[model samples]
Every structure is written in C-alpha cells, then in structure tokens.
Target: MIEGLEPWAQQGLGAATGLAIGLLVGLERGFKLRRQKEGKRVAGVRTFSLLGLGAGLAGVVAETQPIAAAVILLAMLGYLAIAYAPRLTSGGDATSPVAAAVTVVAAFLAGLGNVGLAGAAAAILVFILALKDEIHQFVDRLEERDIHAIARYGIIALAVLPFLPNEEMGPYGAWNPTKLWWVVIIVTGFSFAGYVANRLFGARHGTIATALIGGAYSSTAVTQSLAQRLGQTKGGGAEPAGIALASAVMYLRVIVLVAILANRILLPFVILLAPALIVAWVAGWWLYRQAEPSDAPAPPGNPIALVPALGFVVFIAIAAVAARWAQGQFGEQGIAILLFLMGSMDVDASIVTAGGLPPDLIGAELAAIAIGGTIIANMAVKIGVTLAYARRNGWSAALALLASTLVLAGSIAVAWLRL
Candidate 1:
C-alpha cells in the first residue's frame, strides 16, 4: 500500500493524520462545551475541523512556497486572538481560545511529517483536560518538600548527569563517572516512583500497599520501618505480612535489574531464584490474609537526598574497584567472596559491579553466583531487621523470610554443583 503512493499522496496521508488528531481533540472540546449556550461556546467541532484543514493545506503549500505557510499560521493566530478578544471583554472564559490555539499548532506539526509527536501531544492534552479534578486534587496534596524533591531530581538527572565524564577512571578502570551516575539515576528514579505511589495510595490502601510499593526503593528499609511500626502496636499480623511481601518484592526487583543489565545471566538467575520468589509471594499473601487491616504511613523524607546519592556513588565505586582488584589478585574465587561480603550492606552495588564485569575476566555463570550470594546476604539482613524491631510479631515474618531464602540458597547450591 505504501509503495503505490506518489509524493503528493504521501503528503496527503500525513495531512490526513493531522486532520484526524484535530477532529479527535475537537470532538472532546465540543462535548465539553455541549451544555453551554451556542454563542457562549468559543470554538466547536466545525471550527476546529476547519482550522486543522487550513493548517494542513498550508503545509502542502509550504513545499513550494514557505512564505505562504508563514502567512497562514499568522492569520490563524490573528483570527483566534480577534475572536477571543470580544469574549474576554464580555467576561467569557479564556480556556477555549487557548485550547484552539494549541490545536492549530499541533495540527500544523502533524502535517509537517511529525504525526507521531502531534498525535501523542494531542492525546496527552486531552487526557490532562479530562483529569482536571484529579490533577487539582494531586496538586492540593503536594507538600513543599515534594516540590523540592522534584527539583532535586531534575538537577541530578538533567543538570549534573550530562556534565559527568563518560570515560573510565580510577583503579582497574573500575570507575566511570557517567555509568555510576546512571546507576544513581535508576535507584533514585525507582525510589521517587515509590514515593509517589505511597503518597497517592498508602493511607487508603494500608500496610500491604506501602510494603509492596516501598520494596522497589529499599526492601530492607521497608522491613526495618514496618518492624519498628509493629513494635509500637499491640500484636496484629500486619507487620509480618508487610515484611514478607516487601522481601518477596525485592527478589522480583533483582530479577528485573539482572534482566536489564546482565540479560545473558538473567535466564539462569531466574531459573534458580523464581521458585523462591513465588513461594515468598504466596506465603506473604497468606500472611496478609491472616492480618487485621492496618494503615502504614508513608516513609518520611525525600527519596533522592544528595547525601544518599553521594554515598551510593562512593559505595559503587568502592565495590567496582574491589571486585576488579579481587579478580585480578585471586581470580573468580576472590570476586565471589567479595560479592558475599558486599551483599550484607548493598546488594545493588554488587549486582551492578558483577553485571559490569568484563566477560574475559569473569564469565556469566560466576557473575550469577556472585549475584546469588548477594541475594542470600541481603535476605539475611532483612531477617535480622525483622527480629530486631518487630519483636512481638517478628517470629512469623522472620520464619517466612527464612523459608524463602533457604529455597533460593538451595537452588543456588544445585546450580553451583552443576557448574
């Protein structure tokens, strides 16, 4: 079908895409203004459709006469301004006129071979308009700290990251500033997303929701926090359930990170660990079923604090250098041992370093083992937290977590024996 189209026909198809977008947007606007008196509605389906067609025709004219396209755009803007001026003078709303202006611009871009962007923007605009109430509610809910958190994220991702040197530096070529910052970005982004989820749903959804969402940021931290909360309460089962679920989610998080950064090893990693993950999830769900419903407050503080980001940079740099040095000095065994130790403090850093290992130095199987060690060690930390803080209700949660860890350890053992 595409092959048969001539140049003019191809341009026509582009224009048609633009026209469709405009019509879709216009349909929504018309529906929105349907209750308004006819004269009070600033623009409607017919007006919008004509504007889109005019923009598209101008695009066609631009191929031969760019000046004509410019004139057309200016004329459309002037017409919209003139139409809206009288309405504003008479105390009418400005929303319809602003929307009309934006629609025309989107239509013009769509006709200029930017159909994808124009369509996406139009769809997004419509969605935003539709969600007016929800948007206002969300804004009302935001605290000053939340705005500061967003600003910090923008600085980290947009301002600072781009300026970092991409080349490898430090000992054993272990530290690349760009790569380290990217890891920071991934962690911060995950935490920020979890923070948003917690804000939006935590109070209404209770402990299970908090734990499940919070796991993406820091499962160990979630476990610790839940345990502390449980300590203060009279014995209810919510703490155990939250802890188990969060710990289970951590395994899934690991699986995802491995799949992204070490895909070649993901198959073996999943095969060995997935059964444990399933068992943990089922056990957690059962615990949740047993628990009395209880709300868990969102974790306090900004998710992407500068101190933590800097700390992560230091931690990862050290882990990477340690892993490289260990491999150089003691071969694969050294790297494996280091990974086990590192796992107790930060499994993520171990996983990142292991995934980044040069293939010639450490094979995929060995890297997977290193990752498995970190998983086991990280689970141990969570188990310790459960025991330390959730004193009254800790046993059940700790037992459930231990059961999952043992399954994972058994799988790793079997895989190691085969290797």
Candidate 2:
C-alpha cells in the first residue's frame, strides 16, 4: 500500500505542476484578450487553464486503470467540442483552431510530464504564439505565383527527389540527378528570398531597385521585363529615357555575378563598375523622371522560375561532357575557351561545368573569367533583343545602354584577371 501510494503521490505532483505552468501562461493571455475584446476564434485563458488542469487530472486517474477506455472517453469529448464549435462561434475567426491546438498540446504535455518528459514546452509554445500575427501577415503577403514556386520546391523534395537514381549517370560518371536537384533547390530558395525582398523593399523604390532584385531571379529576365515596361509611352510614343534608367540597374547586376562566382576578384570589378552604374543611374533616373507616365504597369519577367529542375539537369550533363573534353584536348585554356563560349548560351551551364573541372585543368580565376565572359555575351544578346522588341528603339538610349554594359563587362573581366 505504501509503494502504490508513493507512485500516486509522485504522479499527482507532476500533474499539478503541469497544470500550474499551463494556467500561468493561459492567464496572461486571457487577461490581455479580455482587456482588448478583440475577437479571434479562440477560447480565452480560463478555458485553456481548465482544459490543462482537467487533462492532468485525467492522466493521473488513467495510470491505475484502462488507458484505452480513458482515451476513448477523451476522444468523444474532443469530437463533441469540435463539432459544436462552428455553431457556438458566431463571429468565428481563423484562430479558433489554434486555441484548440493549444488545448491538445497542454493535454499531451500533462501525459508526457507524468512520464518525466516535456521540459519547458510551455515556454516555447508561448514564444511561438506571440509571433503569430507577424507570421500570418508574412504568409498573407506571399504572391500566388510565389506560392506555386514553393509548391514546386516541395514536389522536387518530396516526390521527384527521392525516386531519382543517386548514382552518377552517363559515360564518365560525371552527372547525378540528385546533386542537380540539390542545386535546383538552392537556386529556388534564393529566388524566393529575392522575390520576397523585392516585394517588400522595391515596391516604390524605382526601376533601378526592381532590376537589382529581378537580376537575382535572372538578369536576362530582368532585362526583358524592364525594357518592355519602360517602353510603354504616353499617347503614341514610347519612353526611351525610362528604359535607359532601368539599364543602370542591369550594369550593377552584371558586376554582381563576378562577386557571386569569385569574390576575391570583385574588388577591381566593383570599383570600375560602380562609377558607370552610378552614372547611368543618375542619367537614366533624370530621363525616366522626365518621360515616365504616372500610371505605369509593372515589368513583365517572372521574379521566380520554379528552379527548372530538369533544365538544370540537362545543363549539368552537357557541361560535364564539355568540361571533360576541354580538359583532355586543350588543357585549362581550352576549358576556359569552352566556358567563355558556352556561357553565352547559358551562364549557369558554363559555371557548373567550370566548377567541376579538375583542379589541374583550370585555375579558379580562369574559370571565373570564362563565366564572366559568358555574362558579357549574354548582355549583347539582351541588348539585341531589346532593340528589336522595344517600341522606342533609337540611337541615343541604345548608345548609353551599350556603353554601360561594356563598362560592366570590363569591370567583371578585370576582376577575374587580377587584384
């Protein structure tokens, strides 16, 4: 009898302690709720406190008897409350389930604490609850397209990711779908971050700001978007000045790629590029301010591209082959030439290939230079595309943009070459 009594007393103490913690946290919330009278779809502090206390009591009683029977009884009561909640709650808000979840947690904690677990869970729970509004607002601001991007990420992770063969594929054991997918995930995550930052900080900051954020998504996409948006003119004319100004942001983006791929070399590039970028910004902003209509739509490029999983895989495959061939035939110089050439078609492909090149085959700076050259090649392509696509395709703005791009390219090259 004394042994039994000891276990009961210990269980009872733990149950009481769990109840106290839950009640203290709940009471503070309840007082705040009552004072504000702001209706959320959640039960107040007293309800939470009672739920926790009752759960602890239930757990203590269950230890001596049929655990399954106690669970069944609790389930029936829980179901009844949930079923009745919709009818009982008149101005039913979104938070009611959150409150119910807290009740469930409190019960779980009571049971776990009886087993000597659940250390400081209540404190962590309170901290999470405090940040509820900020979390919700952030999720709410997320664009539908951005949501799709996240879903794509999930598909890549949960679905396509696991099924893919992990071993290297092709002739030289150089390609792995799993590895490529990992890169896709990384790029996708970065793109999503850029998108959110763009939305938050670049909303009204100006086209230059948009380009900076957009470039993070893809500089090509950014260039196309800015050209299209800025070329829409008042009455019957296009705005060359506005488009010119946005190109200033493009120069900065070009310079940025060097920093990303090879930071040690970005000093020379950053110095050279900053002046031209700033000059373009000032000149372009002046022109844009003079020419732009107040009611202009946003640019046309998607800030996020779902991380093109398959495309990245294909890129890796081809680049691996090319990298191997370049190493065999022409050494590091040949690899550099290949990277510089292929980079025009897709900068990512060249970078991936160069990254995998044997250390003896290519120095890091030389590889970076090839990648930087590809960026320059891409700039020329974008400029050519914009000239044809733009409504206000003319000599003056074109010359200025061309000059800016050349300077940006030079900055990247110089950085890659030396200190």
Candidate 3:
C-alpha cells in the first residue's frame, strides 16, 4: 500500500501507524496501573504516545542518516533504563520498563515502513500484558511432562522440519524428506492439541467431551483406553458412548487430513464417509443420553511421541514407494489395491501416499474409493479390538461401529455405481 504513495505521504502514514501502535499498548498498560498512585507509575498513555511520536520521526530521519537513527534508539533506551533504575534496585517487576523499550522499537519499525511487523508485535505485546494473570495460572497448571512435550514439539517443528531436504528420493522417487516430516508434524501437532485440551476441560466436561478431544489425535487409542476402563468395572453407558463418539471423531480427523494433503479425493471421500460419521455420532449421542454420568477416563500418553513420529515417516515412505510400484505393475487398479491394503494398517499413510501420486495415475473418484476401503478396514480393526479387549462389555460400542461400517459400505457401493 505504501509503495504507491509519494515519499512525504508514506512518511506521514508511517508516523500515523506508529502512533496507533503506541496508543494500543499504552491503553492496556494504563488500565493495568489505574489503581496505582500517579507518581508510582513509570509510564502511561501520554508518555508512551510522545515516546512513539519521537521514535517515528527519528525513523523518518534515519532514511538518510543511519547513525542518527541509532543515536535516537540508544537515547530512548537510556532514558528507559534510568527511569526504571529505582524499580530494578527495589527488585520490583521490570516488565513495564521492558515493555516501554519494546514500544519504542515497534514505533521505530513502523516509521521504517515495516508496518505489518510493528503492528503484529504491538498487538502481541498488548495481549500478553492483558492476559497476565490468566497466563500465569495456565503456567502453574503445566506439569513437567507437559513442558517436555512442548520442547519436543518445538524441536521437531521449528528445529528439525525447516532443515530437512525437500527433494524426492528413495524407491520410485517416492519419498520427500520434508513432506514426510510435515505429515508427522501435522499428526503430532493434532495429538498435542488434543492432549492439552483434554487436560484443560476433560475432567469438568465428562466422558463425551473427553472422547471428542481424544479423537483429535488417536481415536483408536481412545477406544482402547475407554474399553479397558469398561472391562475393569460394570461400566456405565457413558463408556460405550465415549467409544462411539471417539470413532465419530476418527471420521472427522480423516476427512480433515484428506482435505489438507489430498484435496482431489475430498469430495468423494466425504460422500462415502459422511453416512458412517453421522451414524456414529447419532448412536453415540443416544447412548450417552441413556447413560448415567461417569468419570472422565484417563487422558492419552505423551503429546509428541517422537519415536512413533519417526516410525510413521518411515511407514509413509514405504507406502509411497509401494504405491508407485503398484501403479507401474497394474496401473490405476493396482494403486487402488495398494492403498486399500496399506490403509488397513495406517489410513494416514495411505492418504499421504495417494496425495503424492501423479494426477494421471489415478482419478479422484477412484482414489476416494480406495481410501474408503481403508476406512472400512480400519473400523474393522477397532471393532475387533473392542471385542477382544472389552469382551461382552463392549457389545454396545461394537454394535454402534458395526452399524456405521454397514452404512459406510453401502455408501461406497453407491459411489461405485455412480462411477
């Protein structure tokens, strides 16, 4: 936007933006300190506004005089340090002084025509300041494992993901290191988000809420967990309801992953899977209504399971290579067969593989059918797990899933007919 403006106009706009940034942060700070005595507060809206105005004008000058800009920044920093000296020596909170310095820097950036960055920084600063108490309370609730999980996620996402090569390699040139790792990151990130949400709300919201959240990452795992809980006791209807609800969430997760990684198949995939999704949810809600309230089941394990994530990347690579070979050997039909077989064990891997395939190798309709088969196969596995592990106690869940599976099969058949 600024690029089209004359230099004088751009400078005026930049100065105005800087003033707005300052006002935003200053308002928040002033509100927080409203109860304090006037002299006790180091800075307020007026002081901050002047500081921003001075910084913006300095930035305008800096376009031609770099040293002048540096001197202006240093002078502001020096003033802040001196103003905050008594607070520092008294061991009081130093956040205000630091915030003041940041405000000056953001205003300067704005004046330099980096309006986006400056605006974003100022907004974030105000948000952090406003949420001080809530943020601290949240920090207090975090456990050591939770902290470690965060760090692990950071390593994989921020540290490891960027550095990986993006070139295709391995058999049939199927594997791209960055793409595979990205799948891992997406899966793990979902799991982490679910885990954190479960920790925050599962206890108060009861079994159904837990099921919904848990399903975000691994519905199979959620199923097994709830099934085991049921097997141990007479179990309330909520347990079966939770199990069904988690399965419903599985459909939601799959549909989302398909949309993100393989949008070509999304329409057919959703059409084929929507019946099962609806059936599962309806059954779950019915069962939950009949059941008495029960304790929320224990949440899942670690958020970012690094070892499993690495293993998943390897599996995706194998599936991708195997899918390519299958396409070569028997054309599109062979690729469908490959996806169905691989998806029985890992639907996500199959989705990623299908997404990476050449556009001509298989049409979207056929790809969706192949993935639908995998979904059915995966549902069968979960049903078997429920039966084997939960035994008679799991009959309600098994039956609900059975109904969905039947509906899903019928949908696939109808889709096949349309083709």
Candidate 4:
C-alpha cells in the first residue's frame, strides 16, 4: 500500500487542497466584487486557483534561492496591474487590491499547512470573505460613540496605564497608581460583563443579578427600580420574593467587594457566614418556589459607566492612604474604625484591601467583621427603602419581601448552629 503511493502523491495532494481552497475563496471574492454594484470582473474561481498554485510553486522554488520568492511576488503584482489597467481609471480605493492579494496568499498558505494551523486558515478566510457585505454594512452602521469607546479603551491600556507612577503617595502612603488602576480595571471590567449578562440572561435568572449590578452602580437606583416595578404590577407571592432576592444579593455584593479589598476580614466572614449565606440563599430559592411563578419583571438597573470608574479609582486610592495611616496611628483598632465606616458607604473596598494584610500590620479579622456588620446594616436600609416604596407605590409586596428577609436572617443565624 505504501509502495503504490508515489513521491509525487504528496505534492499532488497539496496542489489539490490548494486548488479547492482557492476556488472557494475566489468565488467569495467574486461575490464581494458584484456587491460593489460593479459589472463582473476577470478574477474569479479559476483565476484565484491558478494564482494560488503559481504562488505555491514559487514558494517551493524560493527554498533554493531566498530572493527568488520576492522576485516572483513582485512579478505577480505586475501581472495584477496589467490585468486591471483599464479598470484602474474607475477603480477607486474601494477596489481594495490589498484585500484580494491577502485572500490569495491565505488560500495558498492553507495548502502548505498540513501540520500546524495551516489549511484551517484558508477555510476561515473563505468564511470571512463571504461576510464582506455584512462586514461592510456593520462598519457603516457603527456610530461615533462606538468608535469613541474602542479608542478610549485603547488609550487607557496603551497610553495611561503604561505611564502611571508606581510610587506610594499621601498620608496612609500605601497607594500605588498602577495598583489602584488595576482595582479600577477590575471594577470597570464588570460593567461590560454585567451588561452582557443582563442582555443575554434577562430577568429570568431573578432580580439578583440586577441587585448586584445595581449595588455596583447605585443601590439607591436599585431601590427606585424595585419600587417602580412594584407600582406597575399587582402584589403577588413573587413580588415579595423579588425584594428578598435583591436584598440577599446585597450581601453577596458586599462580600465580593470585601474579597477583593480586605481578604483577612473576608476570610472569617466567609468562614462564619458561608453556611448561613448558603442556607439563606437556598431558603430564599425555596421561598421563591413556594410563591406562584409570575414572569419576573425586567430588572431595573444600569452598569457603572466611565465617570464612575474614575471616581472608584480615586476613592480606592484615598482608602489605601487611610489604611496606611490607620496601620501606624490606629494600630489594630484603626482597621476596625476604617472598615466600620467604609464598609457601609461601600463595603467591598475596605474589606478587599485588608486581605493578606498582616495581623500586626492591620486587623484582618476586624475588617471582615466590619464588612458583615455593614451588610447587616444595609439590610435594614433596604427594608426601610422597600417599605417606603411600598407605601408610595401601594404595593404591600415589599412588606412580605421584608418579612421574608427577616426570616432568612433568622435562618442564617440558625444555619450557623453547628458551625
């Protein structure tokens, strides 16, 4: 069987593959030309296939003399010029010869790629070429705002991030610009994530995702959203369940924040509250089931925007400085004070910042306690918000939601029984 396959067979196989790919890509290019509302052009399937074949042979010859390939490539360019000489008068920049040349090269490379990522590229190129109309249409539709977003991200990563000073600054003296920027990056990166999640997943996943993102943007906004939603719909089992769900997510949000900023304190809270939180959430889920299902309303919230990202970075920088000061002046007590105060305003920053900070350097445990206490404190605020909104909206559902949360809190305390 091996003897029947001659040496020429391998070369023939490559040629065959190259010709097939070239034919497909060439057809796609022809369609692209037709879409320009131009008459038929000379270059089509056969033309492209031959171009690939000739290029492939030239590449083989260049193995003996390196300069030979460049000579062939330049010669091919001349042939292309001759072919389009008459059309050149009308062909404006839209003709895009570079794109055509690249298509041919890609098809040729696909035949060569028997081992590494070779022929697959040709297939991908063919598909991409097929989408030329759609691609062009997409580009045409992108507004100035879209371009600005892309450019803004580029400037941040390429220009601003690279030049920032790494040195500590101010009273607490722990702040580093890069580190703070990275914190901003973490928080800001989630905006896109949350946006995509909310768009793709919708409210069927429950209002929890809404609450988390809302907490990031503004918990006050989330309260307003919930209140408005309550006003629109008749109070039902699912209504109170939604409120409890949002409030539960609040704890999760604070916990996530603390995990990033103050891990030492977060670790204990995780240890203490892990079971309680799990039980509370699980019970909430069960409570959710007990209420008859209504299509959950679309969550009312928005992701954090660019200004918020900058504001958060500045706040984190300030917190880092405050933490450094407390380390020296407040000793262990400084952490408790900082965490207790900051955990409520925005708990995650203080809590996450404390992680891995030494007990002697900073009180990690106290920081964790502060985060938990803040979450608990926030619960009370949510209840007040819910009640007030209920009164204004005339949806008694908030009362049930608040009652469910109280029950959940009790269950959490109970869940910690063995722990």
Which candidate tops TM-score? 3
Q: By TM-score, highest first, what's the ranking?
A: 3, 1, 2, 4
Error of 3 at 89 (Å): 3.6
Residue 342, model 1: lDDT of 80
Give one digit per residue, the lDDT tens place, for model 4 in 203-270: 54555555544444345456666666666665553545555555555556556765665555666667
TM-score of each: 0.92, 0.64, 0.93, 0.61
lDDT of 2: 0.60
Compare candidates 2 and 3 on lDDT and give the better one.
3
User: What would the TM-score be for candidate 3 when compared with the true structure?
Assistant: 0.93
Candidate 3: regions farther than 4 A off = 388-392
Clashing pairs in 1: none
Tell me the lDDT of candidate 1.
0.82
Alpha-carbon shift of residue 405 in model 1 (angstroms): 1.2
Flag the better candidate by lDDT, 1 or 4: 1
RMSD of each candidate relative to the true structure? 2.4, 7.7, 2.1, 7.6
> Which residue runs does candidate 2 get wrong by more than 4 Å?
1-42, 45-91, 99-150, 165-169, 192-212, 234-296, 301-308, 391-400, 412-419
lDDT of 1 by residue, 62-158 (tens): 7788999999988988999998899889898787787778788878877776777877888987787677779898999999998889888888788
lDDT tens digits by residue: candidate 2, 10-54: 667656755665576676567546665466425566666665666
